[model samples]
Target: MPFGGKARWGVRSTVALLAAITGLFLAPATVPATAASAKQSSAAKALAGKYVPVMMIRKQGENLCDTKVEQYQVMTVDALFGNPDVRLMRNNGSSKSTLIKQAPTIDDVRNRGEEAYIDLPGDPLGDTCVYSKDFTRMKNEGEAPVAVYAHIAREKGHSGIALQYWFYWYFNQFN
Candidate 1:
C-alpha cells in the first residue's frame, strides 16, 4: 500500500469533511419571507403614480451637427412605455422635447439626434432607482443609444430612498 491503507483512508475522510463544511458556508442565503414581502410592498408604493419623461432635448456644447437648432430631441423609456406615474426630470441645459411625439427606432434616433438625456430623480432624504438593459443584450443587438430610468424610493424600514435604474431598451443609437 502506497502511504499505508489506514493513512490513505484517513486523508480521504479529512478531505470529505472539509468539503462538507465548505459547502455549508457557500450555500445560498435565504431572506425571511416576511422581510421580502415588506420590501416588495415598499418598492411598489414608491413607484406608484410617478411621471417620468419620455422625450429629452440636450444642448449641443461643442459637437458639430447639421441641425440649425442647438438642441436635439431623443426618445426615452418613459416615452416608449407611456408610464404616467414617474415624472420626467431635467437639468440646467436639458428639458422635455416637443419634437419627438412618439417612440423612435434606433435608426430614427441616429438619423435625427445626437444624444438623449434623462435626468435621474434626486431626493435628499430618499434613494433613487435606475434601470437599463443588460450589456450582453445590448451588444448582441447592435450599437445604439439606449435609455434607462430610475426611481427615488424608500426601502422598508429605511428613511432614505433607494436608487434603482430599470432596464428598458436593448439598443439606442446615437451618432
Candidate 2:
C-alpha cells in the first residue's frame, strides 16, 4: 500500500503545479481603466483612419550571448470604420515570431501618450536579450513610425519572470 500512496501523492503534486502554471498564463480583468484613460479614448476616436505600422528590432549594444533584444513599432491611425483597427507585424530580431494584440484604447491617443518598457530575460538558455526602449524618443526624432495591434502585448512567463508588452499610441498633426 505504500507504493500506492506515493503514486497518489505524486499525482496530487503534479495537479497542483499545473494549476499554478495555468493561472499565470491567464490575465486578470483588474487592469484599471482610469479617468485619464477615458479622456484619451475620446481623442484617439478622432484619428480613427488608416495609418501604417513600421518597426525595427536590434540589439542596443553588442549582441552578447545574454544581451536583451529591443523592439520598436509605430502605427499611424487614420480612422477605419471611423476607428483604429490596424495590426502590427514583428520579428524577434531574428525569427518571424508573430503576435497580435489589441489596438490602443481611445484614451491612449487622447493623452498624447508615450511608453518606455523593459522586457526581462525570458529563457533560461541565455539565448534571449533584455528589452528596453523609449517609444516617444523614437517618434520625436521623425522615425515615421506606426503602431500595431498585434505587438500591443501578450503575457509571457519563463525563468520565473512574468512580463506584459503593449503598443504606444499617439497622434500627429499630419504635416
Candidate 3:
C-alpha cells in the first residue's frame, strides 16, 4: 500500500518540528562514513533504478524459544523518488541514467539519510520496507524536513540511515 500524493509543505517549521519530534521520543542520528562522492555513485546505482520492499520475509526469533514469522508477501516495486509531476533527480544533479519511471508516493519512501530517521508506516523498526538507496534520497519538492537524507553504516554492514540507534550487528547483517 503506497501512500499516494505529496503532502502540501513549505510551512517552515524546522524549530517546531524538531521539538515535536524530540518530544515524541524520536531522536536524530549521526552521519554515515564512506565519502559522499563514492556513496552517491554507488547508492545511485543500487537504488535509483530498481528497489522493492516486502511486508515480511520469514521472520525468526534470535533465540530458539521465539516464535517464527509466517507472512512473506510482497508489494509492487513502487517508484520512490516522488510524484510523477515532481522531478527529484534533477535537484540532486542526477539528470540521466534512471530506472524508475514514476516516483513512489510518500509511503513508498524507504528513507535515504546516512544517520537520519524516517517515519515509515507501521510500528517503528521501519515496518521492514526495502527500496533503492538512491531513490530514498531522491527528493520531490526541495526534500522534506524529515527527508534529511544522509548516509550511515549502522556500526558494521548496516547500510541505511535511521533516526534511532539501529543495532547494526543484530538485524541489519547482509551476510
RMSD of each: 23.5, 21.1, 20.3
lDDT of 3 by residue, 1-175 (tens): 1122222342111111111122122232443334654444444333321321212245433332222442111212222235453322222334443333244554433453332222222231343433222223332233322211112223345555433211111112132
TM-score of each: 0.21, 0.15, 0.18
Better of 1 and 3 by TM-score: 1
Ranking by TM-score: 1, 3, 2
- What are the runs in model 1 whose C-alpha is more than 4 Å off? 1-50, 56-64, 67-141, 153-175
Identify the runs in model 2 with alpha carbons over 4 angstroms from their true place.
1-60, 64-101, 106-126, 130-175
Q: After superposition, how far is residue 134 of candidate 2 from its true place, in Å?
A: 11
User: Model 1, clash count?
Assistant: 34
Weakest ten-residue segment in model 1 by summed lDDT: 12-21
User: Candidate 2 lDDT, tens digit per residue, 123-163?
Assistant: 22333422222233434565424433311122355343222
Model 1 residue 35 distance off true place after TM-score fit, in angstroms: 8.4
Worst 10 residues of 2 by lDDT: 11-20
- Give the distance in Å from residue 124's predicted Cα in candidate 3 to where it truly belongs: 38
